[model samples]
Target chain A: MNDTNSVVSIKDVKKAFGKNVVLDGINLEVSRGQVVVICGRSGSGKSTLLRCIDQLESIDSGEIRAAGHLMGFKEFNTKLVPLKDAAIAKQQRDIGMVFQNFNLFPHVSVLENIMLAPMKILKRKKSEVENEALALLERVGLPDKKNAYPRQLSGGQQQRIAIARALAMKPKLMLFDEPTSALDPEMISEVLDVMIDLSKAGMTMIVVTHEMGFARAAADRVILMHDAKIVEDAAPRDFFEKPRSEHTRLFLSKILQH
Target chain B: MSWSWPYFFDYMNNGLMLRGVWVTIWLSIISMTIGLGLGIFAALMKMYGNPAVRFISEFYIWLFRGTPILIQLVIIYTGLPQLGIRFNVIESCILGLALNEGAYLAEIIRSGIMSVDKGQEDASRAVGMNWRERMWLVILPQATRTIIPPLGNQFNGMLKTTSLCSVISMQELMRSAQMIAQIEFRVLEAYCIAALWYLLLVSIWGLIQTRIEAHYEKPFGSQEAVSNSEK
Candidate 1:
């Protein structure tokens, strides 16, 4: 299923934590401009799959490619060897990730948090980076909060700023690991609205969220994972209306009742 | 033989005592500065280095911290000279004190770095930071919040620890007091002046430490009700 147009391709990716296998034979392909939302139970390895794409969690075995490079390994004389930290870091730069907890640097202002990576990693001009950072804050609808600290912001505001921070690097692919999972009920839609706008702008994204509304509204393909495997992959309408897998039907019944 | 008020008052304001105070202050500042650098380097090595590098850091900490600073000072200043490694009194004092201080500070820094939330590292890594950038930009800045209070206490101890160097005839506060007591035979009076001066230095440092702690605690910005306003 991998193609030149695909931004992310995973082949038989597997991962484990000690004796607990997390991702088992997980294969997925996300094309450019595709918005794929992954839904699964808490221990279902949905988050691990997303994390493995950026090498935040190393896979046990498999080939996963994103942004035109292998995730954590390089082909050295036809043998797969793990890339060095600097090399892995360069690969990571092309991919952006937003965490469930937001993880905004509490010591810096919102503007600085957004500006840090582009200036330090990319070595862009400070003035130019500052202007771009300001524009990102504006895009996230928080221009006046440029100088505010992360602790001073609400949970929703911080997550938005986290997204803006990731966007500052201008990543080719963005991964959201339950981005709105930690937000207050009223704040969820605000963060999701920004995400919906991002998806509409043709950014390739893989979001691991239980917010089915997001799946219906923004996702081009909705994936259901269970027992460390992808059990369902279909358009939102078919996945919701005409479920195929026994796991999908069971997951939908459990999810939609909430 | 008596507690001479004249000798006590004279020693407190005398040129020799004043010079001793100056030496103690500069020695503490320079030694503490170098100790902090050594500490940070050692802590990073212990936490992240390969086995060989980590072993070096661990052994340095173990050797220095295992012995008394007084013994360490004597070895560096006196013992090393017989072995063809002769340093002047000031250099020996700094080298000995800094080496001892670094051992203690290394553990303090390691705990401080550990205290920072793990999410900070994850965020930094996701943003494409290498290990160096992650440390200097993200981890250490936050760790400074936890490191300052303990670091202040260490500095307070270091001010008095410099007195140990007096055994080597380095002529800091304690040595100056001993010299005056030897001639004037006002042992109690001269030593009391040195004690009071040490007290004064630590008290000044305490005030400065409070300001530093306050600065780090609110490093982001002032309280302006940004969160309150949002809700």
Candidate 2:
């Protein structure tokens, strides 16, 4: 990817917790409006990398730049000052994250859940936010369940509401951390359909998922991570067909077998 | 030897017994309010505060829980006098009752807070709520449902515990009963009156508890009943 067109840039990112090293010297770049899929076996730090981008997980060392703003490190007194929790939250509002668990507020209705961030963080007028929230809910095909609590919705519908809640913030980039991994097998396709439509709309997204079909169909580029490093990064067709790394070939072989 | 209804009214007519009931209600309300406030703070400190704060909270719980409430009352009301901290009988009784009750209330509040799902915290954080905001808006609201039943139990226990204050000449229910028995030499009548008053107060509190529990119960449905019934 050309350096100038990149919206997210990570360089030499290293993170460790006590004796366990999670991400070791990782580097990646994503251009504006591109869907990049990250796939790896469990414990390969795929989720940690996405978390680091949102500053949810602090990095031990490195730099990350998103939409021209430096993230993951705070500068103070000629040295980097660790960003406070509130400051990190302010930055995170610009990039919404969707979790595998669908993490909806159980007590609030679907409408309230979607409107909460916009009302609380953006201080948007409730009527205008409700209008926008209704539109997003309609888009997700859950207009009928607007007043229903999360427990009342199916896993597929809950995940769709989660997607709409993220979209309510109008984030420049969206991160999905195994969004479909926790769904029931039958519910997976509904969420994937929503994501496929989102990608077609040119929404910039970084997705950490094991769904090969989603990678093959929707991802503009696919990145394969192993042992805390990216072993292969290429267009989906080439990465699957002509994987240069032995690790990539083995990974593709194993995943394709299933 | 038979039950004497006229003697019960006679005991009620005694100014000392009537005053004792007033004093008993006053002590219960004040001590319970203080206990509930301290309980909430201790619970928050134990659950969400830093190591030092949590350590202090744990130490407070340990110190009070390790000792008997009667012993605590004696220490506060009697022992402190030797150190020149000469609080009046009412102040001493309320302080002793509040401090002892606060420890038990803290445990109740902490358990209530813990019962909330961790996912709720993550959901709140995902929406960019800070720790204080998350605790105040999300965790505490849900915790209220968990806390009410135990809080009702605590208030009932506090009503009984107020009897301990009579040891320090506080002239509350039991103390007034002792005075009336001494004057009229009607030991059975005065003591019976005090017992009846205690029962009546506790039963009334039980009614209020039922109402408060029901109010908080609406959002939670039967989940709380299943958990609390087991407890």
lDDT of 1 by residue, B1-231 (tens): 668788888998988999999999999999999999999999999999999999999999999999999899999999998999999999999999999999999999999999999999889999999889999999999999999999999999999999999999898999999998898688899899999999999999999999998778774445564444434
Q: Return the TM-score for each candidate structure.
A: 0.96, 0.86
List-wise, what DockQ does each model earn?
A: 0.60, 0.29
- Candidate 1 docking DockQ: 0.60
Model 1 spans with C-alpha error above 4 angstroms: B219-231
| lDDT per residue (tens digit) for residues B29-124 in model 2 | 999899888888998899878999999999998998999888988888789889988888888888888888888999988898898887677666
lDDT (CA) for every model shown?
A: 0.93, 0.85
The alpha-carbon lDDT assigned to residue B136 of candidate 1 equals: 96
Q: What shift in Å separates residue B201 of candidate 1 from its native position after superposition?
A: 0.8
In candidate 2 chain A, what residue range of length 10 has the lowest lDDT sum? A66-75
Query: Which DockQ-derived CAPRI band holds candidate 2?
Result: acceptable
Per-residue CA lDDT of model 2 for A1-258, tens digit only, reads 247778799989999888888899999999888999999999888999998887777888988877555774566776877777777666777787888888887656789989988997789999999999999998888898887767667789999999999899888788999999998999999999999999999888999998999999999999988988988899999999998989889998999996
Candidate 1, number of clashes: 0
